[model samples]
Every structure is written in C-alpha cells, then in structure tokens.
Target: MAGARVTTGSRLGVRIREVPVPADLDAPDAWLLRGQVDTVNEVEIALRGNRDMCRNPHETLGSMREQRYTTKIRLVAVDEDRPGDAADPARVLGHAALHLPRQDNTHTGEVDLGVRPAARRRGIGSALHDAALEVARVHGRTMLTTTTQQTSEPTDGPLALAPSTGSGRLHRDDPGVRFALTRGWSLEQVSRYSVLDVPLPADVLAAHRAAAQAVAGPDVRVVLWESRCPDEWVDQFALLQTRMSTDVPHGGIARHADVWDAARVRTIEQQFLDQGLGYLVAAAEHVPTRTLVAFTALAATPVTDEFVFQNDTLVMREHRGRRLGMLVKTANLQRLAAERPAVQRVGTWNAEENAHMLAINVALGFRPAGGTGEWQRDL
Candidate 1:
C-alpha cells in the first residue's frame, strides 16, 4: 500500500501519504523528504531547546536504502483550501517512519512520529501513529518500540510516571507520554541525554589519556581513522558492533542481538560519506592478537560546524576494567579538536541504568540536558 493517500475528516483536511524513496536529491518529490526532515527538527527544537538530534536529509534517504532494515516513510499534509493560500499545494504537517529490521529482531518494529508544534492538537500525531500501527501489524511485527523526549525529569507526584527500570520518570501529562499510555504502550526505560562542550583543555585531556594508557598497559594501543575502516581491522570492528547490540543495557526493552559483518559495516560507512557526514573512529587494539577490543566514534555534518554526535562506544566485556573506554574516548575527542575545531559541542545518550558508561561520560564533563523514554507495545 505504498503511496496510498488517506484523507481525514479534520478542519484542515489532513492527508497522509506513504512517501516513496527518491532516486537522488534532484528527484521531483524530493521536497517531501526535506519537509519531513524539517518537521522532525522543528519538533525536537521545540521540545529540547536544541536540534542536536536532527538527521541530515541525505542520511535519512541513504538509511532508507540499507538492506539490513526496511524503512517506510509517511508524510502528513494539509490540503490548501484556496488557490493562493500557500506556496505549496499540500503543506507538510508532520511525518512518520516505520523501521522493520530484516535480520535479527524480526518480530519487532520501530515507529517514530512527529508533528509540527503549531499543528498539534489537530489529531495529526494520532493519525500518523495509527497508520504506523497498521503497517506494523501488516508486517507481522509482534512488538513495537518508540521514544519520547523531555527537557527535565518530572517531580515525584501524581503527574509522574516511572518506568519499570525505576531509574527515571516522565511527566504523565506530557502529550507524548499521554499518547502512548492511552494506546497500551508501557514506559520500559529512560535514557539520559547529555552534551559535552568541545575543545576541552588540552592538558586535562592529555592527563586523562596518559592515565588510561597506563592502566591499559602496553598490550593495548589505540588506532584512529576517518571515513572508512582499514581492511585489517574491519572484521574485528564488525564483531564489536555485534557485541554492542546485546551488551548495552536495554532495561526491559524487547530487542535481540543485531548481527553485523564487514559488508554491513562498509555499506553504512559509504552511506555516511554520501550523506556529507565526517566520522572519526578510535579503536583499541589488543597488540598480541591484533584485534579491536574497544571502539568509539564521533560524527558531524558540514551543514553545522558547532555540533557533533557521540555514536556507539563499546568495550568488550573481557576488556572492561583497563580504562580502555576512557582511552579510546579521549583519543577520539583529541582528534576531533585537532581536525574539527569548529565543533563546540558533542551530544550523546545512554541508558540511565548503565552506570559504568554514565560514570565515564560524567568524568568527561558531560552534563545532563534532557532524557528520552523508551516506550514499547506488544500487539
């Protein structure tokens, strides 16, 4: 039912259509893609005060092409009532993305929905959610996952709703929270969203790196690269990604280990490059075996010089105590400062229950900004 149009009986005459993936940036309908990205960023900024989580339109399109996951994009628009009402005949109000993993976690699908701030209370979000649910059911997905962001933790009162993890709470009165609760979704876990001001003092970073190196000993060394992974370490890097899927604290979220290999790794790398993103990776090598025992990645888009994102940072379970996490993170941050000095901030998210990683982030001077609630529903 891709591209099928459905009109709703609202004052604005809202229409929801499944968007087809464009061939390139110059495609005729590419404006819809840009509109989707704009809507999401607008909603995020309205909720959290910063558009740190905004995705480049090129990246979103490239991700849509990945074989490992099937992503369906849907856009909600309002029909113009007058001939000269607006520049665009259909003004985009919001969008929804339903992601179905092809390999592991086949029974689970992820639904991400957002509505423009000025367009809320118009039943647009509920319409998009209902469409996503129908699509998930059609795909035979038994479980669905989504998230809601809040700028601050709600006080412990009647309006607060705590997750089963019991670590963080979200305000029950929040529109997103209320939307999910009334639909049978449960708050599974809360994740702390943090930001670190970049270009930290050179001496401070040097001291942290030196100390971590001492603890890691001579047996472990760090290797840094940009854009692509060298052939020698590609296999090991893939293994770490596979481990990351299961090793991270999920906290009651129904998910399974994601399988990754060298080919999948290479595909994503190429996608990132095509999306105009600059990514740097630092991996800790076990000198004896010459395997990547830990790794961390930092990425930024040239569209914005002031911000970068902290991607996955995973240290193998067996290599946890040697401060390798700190070692790789510091190495990457130092490199980021040297290569992309324009970046003034780095943003990241971690499960609130993951104390070890949280402690590491805290030591790096990252401060809490906001948090997200992982919501799940079993159909």
Candidate 2:
C-alpha cells in the first residue's frame, strides 16, 4: 500500500506517497494509471502549444498499466482538504519513470510529465516531478530528464507529422522543455527529420520493383499488411524487434537491454493501434540452396493530406543487400497510397553517417532533415 505522509506545496493540500505494488492498485487508481498517455497528451499540450503531434506512438493493448507495473511508476494524490484542492483530482500533475541502469541517461525519469493545463503555475508539476526524482534517487539514478521541440524550426522541420490528442496548434514547442531546463536537464541529443517528396517516377518505381524481384527469386516473398494483423505474424514481429534494439543508433538510452521483453513489443504495437498506425510489410527471400536471407519493414504515419511519417525502417543484417530493403519500402508506399490515397509526402531519420540506410533512403527519395547530437550525462 502507498505509505501516505504529509506534504505541503502549491495551492493544494496533498498526501504524497509511494504508489502500492500490483496488489493494492484499486479500480480507480488502476483506471487513472492506465491513462498515462492521456495524461501525457495533456501534459504535453500544456507545455508545448501543439496538441496533435504525438498520436499513434505505441502498438500495445492496456499498454499504460503494463508499463507502470513494469517501470517502477508512482502515482501522487492531491488531498482535497490539503493546500492544493484547486487542482483537479483527475489530473496526473507529475509522473517519472525510473532511470534504471541502461545504455544512456541523458533522458530518464522527469523526462515526461502529465499535468492538467488549468493547474499550471501551481506547484503540482514540481511536486509530482520531484516525487518522480525520489523514485529515481531511491533507485540510485542521478539524471532527471525532459525535452520540448524548437518552435522556430520551420514548416519543414525534421520531425515527421505526428498526431497529438487534443485540439491545439501545430509546429509549436511545449514549455515542458523549460521544465527540464529549470530542473537542470540539458540538451542531450537531437536527431534530424528527413523526407522524400515528389513521388518516384513511375519508371523508377517499376525498375526498382523488378530489380528486387529478380534478386530474391521466386521463393523470396514480400507481404503487405492490411488493416488487421494476422496470427502467424506476431512471433515474426517479435524476432524482428530483437534485431532492432542493437540496430538503432540509440547510443544514450537509459533503460537496460535485459529489461526488454515480448510484453514491451506488444505494448508498442498496442500504442500504435490506439494512435492510428498505417502501412507495414514483412519481407523474406529464399536464397540459393534453400537459405532464407532477408527481412525488414517500412512503417509510416500520415501528418496531413500531403505529409506522412516514414518512422523507422530496418533491414536484418544478414540480409542487407539483395534488394529486400527496397522491396519493403516499395511495398509500404504502395500499401499506404492505396489505403490513404491523398498522402503526397513521406519523412524519416537515420544517423548522420549510416551509409547503408542513407543509401536506401536516398534511392527511394528521402533527403536530409538536419542532425542533432546524442549527448548524455552519467546520472
């Protein structure tokens, strides 16, 4: 059970305490706990002006509760009779996940907050975030993390169009980045967003398809995903994710690799479905003498009628060449266009020097979206 203690701050009288483990999670607490993304959306909106830029981030069911259970998450209740009754009971004023030992620490707990907009200027966020810090401190974690985008970048800024949950303006950075600054979190990393516009010429697409098909031979297969997921694909998807952990240029992630599990992958999928994900493909090619050689995917998100996000695309190491990457990209585009015909552009990112990925992206029409350093602090 949560060990309640008296604490005073902001306009609300509140009992800040540790949230109990799974056993004591009541229905309301459980429900509220499950609403992390909602809290996140509100928190993000309150900080950044745009509210429709973070949709479809994960693809798992009941992902929020599962994450809280897994991450050492906490919930702080504002006592109605206490000093901050002006704050809404339902608002998750602060939230911080443990910065358990991992590959990186520049951004960890204190990175994201979920406070209600109306509760701003009150000490709720600080208290909640500070409470998050307590969770990290007890665990021996040193870094408190957070970030907000730069508002003045450009209409064609690096980020691909992402959907935020509430009705808000677009292209505005949240003030939460300020929260990180005040709390001592510094700019640790920045990645550019790149895109491919002006569709590939019909001749070019046709030639690329033919080349990929010829390279793979008759047994090699590339399958396009429809709206609903199929049963046979789940395990395959998980296997592909294992490869992703090491492949991405995430040199500063704070969570340890051992912490990853099938549940995490499932949650990402659940979050994606909740946010309206679009287009996917799984590729496998039968090499000569019956060897199966390649696999990859091209996934994207629609920003507006004219823009789509080519989020993260990956090709298995052993199957790097042989056109499997191209096959998946072509397939994703074909499927995306068919399902959402009006999308006219696509964007993506890759480490500045990753030649292979850059080659593939360039071939398909992606251009540089700037680059940000992936700096981190040893917390």
- Residue 88 displacement (Å), model 2: 5.3
Q: What are the per-model numbers of colliding residue pairs?
A: 0, 37
Off by over 4 Å in 2: 1-39, 43-61, 67-69, 72-111, 114-125, 137-148, 151-188, 194-220, 226-237, 252-279, 289-311, 321-323, 340-349, 352-379
Angstrom error at residue 352, model 2 = 4.3
Q: Taking the tens digit of each residue's C-alpha lDDT, what string does model 2 give over 1-379?
A: 2535434553665455443333223433343343343555665465445443333223212233344223545555444463443433353444443434332332344434455666566666777666666666666666654444433233544432222211111232435544555665545444554667646676787777778778856767765564334555555555665656565555343543333445555665665555455546555635343432344444444333456666556666766666777776776666665666666667665553456667777777776644333323345
Summarize candidate 1's per-residue lDDT along 1-379 as a digit string, tens digits: 4433444564555666666678986787766777787787788788767666677678778766665555454554544342553435237787888888877888998888898888777777877888788888888899999999888788789998889999888889988899999999999999988999989999999999999999999999999999999999898889999999888888889898998899988988987877778889999999999889999999887558899989999999988999999999999999999988888999998998989889999999999987899999998
> Which residue pairs overlap in candidate 1's backbone?
none
- Please give each candidate's TM-score: 0.94, 0.60
lDDT minimum window of 10 residues, candidate 1: 81-90
